[model samples]
Target: MHLFRGPGFVAGFSDRADGSLDFSDRTPEEAGRLWAGLPAVAGLGLPPPRFAHQVHSTTLLRVGADAPAGRQGQADALMTSVPAMPIGVFTADCLPVLVVAGEAVMAVHAGWKGTRQDITGRSIAALAEATGVSPARMQVFMGPCIGSCCLELGEEVVEEFRATDPGSLACFARGARWHLDLRGLNVIQCLERGVARAAIRHVNDCTKCLSDRYFSYRQMRGRHGTQFSFIARLPEEGAPSSGAA
Candidate 1:
């Protein structure tokens, strides 16, 4: 029931039924059904969405009805102006980004690598350029992620974030060993992209800290179920008026 949206579309990531994605094993169909049920869970009653390969880079793909199936391309973000196309991205600890302006929308997976590479900024720029959404009007929602508390990193990675954003130190603490604040850094990056501060909504839930209500790559150590978050442009006139829970 944790959902976030912008001016045009809605999206959310799911925790396991018990409110945790900390599972050792699960079938692909099991995962599929869980995602397919999102809209109903939200009260929209729509089916699941199409997803991209998510290479953790800054490549943003413009998706429409014609987009190919099974990994739209080697990209970390996907955008669409077409209503109901439902672009989506999957992740355990990576950031799930949903951006919207009127009817044009985008979904992105911004991992530390993607954040360092400026994926959020790049994808937002692409959305504006392709759909003519003024930055002043665009809104971005940064979903749950591995906060700095649990996202420990080596000096090399620490230096990468610091270099990309010197101000990000506020989010990182000198952990017992390394430093990290993947989410804070991403929020700084979002503000840098010209998105209005008032337009950005952040979900404070941390996947790693609130393990029972989220999926955490760090907590699971690579053997975890993945959850998908998605967004799709709704028709301006005839779209269903019923809101999802």
Candidate 2:
């Protein structure tokens, strides 16, 4: 994956599929104690970042400086053309999709449900409508997630792929059950949706295996921290350099 420079935001994921935050690890009171200090966290030199409660459903919003706060919408993905308002997504084994268009960038949380529901397409369409950017002009970065080598699936998942994209079944391997490549499926979706191949970069990092720098819920047996993937359009004045993790 391309290195991301901070003063940006982060998304966390688990290893297996449920890569959500381990609230049990810290009580709401403790989290509140931490949340109380978020402004101080915001005080650090970085672009102001915001996120949403992803529901694995296809709901995308374009955030501006005046947008309301408090998870006002339900969406698996979010995009923004507004400068300095960074968008972020959370995942573990599921894919963390980041899209950039000139000065605008988008962060997507694409779990299997989001993927099957075409969350990427919805987000892109919204951005296109909002910014008038053609898909050819877009750059996509597919971050590390669960690889097909270990992302075994059942008939339900397979059926979902077939229902959405019948040809995607080729990415599935038959065994005692089936091993699938979710990243590959996402790549196919990107290409089919008009994102140029050369413009799309796949980090190909597997969270389950790359435990040193990333958190894998599957490898950790459902008890682990979540790593974040975030991007922000630089401000005209004194923007931080760009990198990736």
Candidate 3:
């Protein structure tokens, strides 16, 4: 679904219906063949989308016009100001966040570890510094992810977040087990970095809860394929923003 559409950019999250966008367990040749058929990437008139090895770390890669098309490296986020060059992240239950500021855009993969490391905040800072755009002027769009209702975490994991970001304690709940709000914590990180609350939008669908529509790692028990979430700044002469697909 299209998460954000402006005069200069378009950002959206893909679903199972769009086909798995990551290689995962598939052979390289099979993956490449399947990627070629993905409807989301076909007919966009943009260059091949850029992705990263997503190690669940806070590493952020910057993509320029000259950057190569395939896997860029190990990173949880990708940012660029180059028009028509799409950047994205693959995720199953982890949050896929898209940020836009004028001509600059970022696609972030915020799994629990990345969130604990404040990847969202770091991306905002990096993009703002690179584009000279204030964090307040940036817009954030979050895609499907595991929600508190289904994201039961162990006490050690809960303590890890609590130790690093005490303020994140508010994002946890005590049920039969500790449930964490991955989306809410990222929103808090964005707000802490000066992004206006009104500027943040998200798809409320829980990946685990909506397994039929989205890929959910937890629901699939480590056998899930990932869907892609992407954004690109269109060239001046490119087509106008078309919301969703």
Clashes in candidate 3: how many?
Answer: 0
Q: Write the per-residue lDDT of candidate 3 for residues 103-188, one digit (tens) a residue.
A: 78999999999999999999898888888999999989999999999999999998898889898999999988999999999999
The per-residue C-alpha lDDT of model 3 at residue 109 equals: 96
Clashing pairs in 3: none
Which of 1 and 2 is the better model by lDDT? 1
TM-score winner: 3
lDDT, candidate 1, 58-147, per-residue tens: 888877666643356678888877675566777788888888877778888988789777788887877888888876788777777887
After superposing candidate 2, which stretches have Cα over 4 Å from the reference?
Answer: 1-44, 68-72, 236-245
RMSD of each: 4.3, 5.9, 3.7
Candidate 1 or 2, higher TM-score?
Answer: 1
Candidates 1 and 3 compared: the better one by lDDT is: 3
* Candidate 2 structure quality by residue, lDDT tens digits, 17-119: 3233333235445533433344433443344345666678888866776654324356667776665555666576779888876566788888777877778
**What is the Cα-based TM-score of model 2?**
0.77
RMSD of 1: 4.3
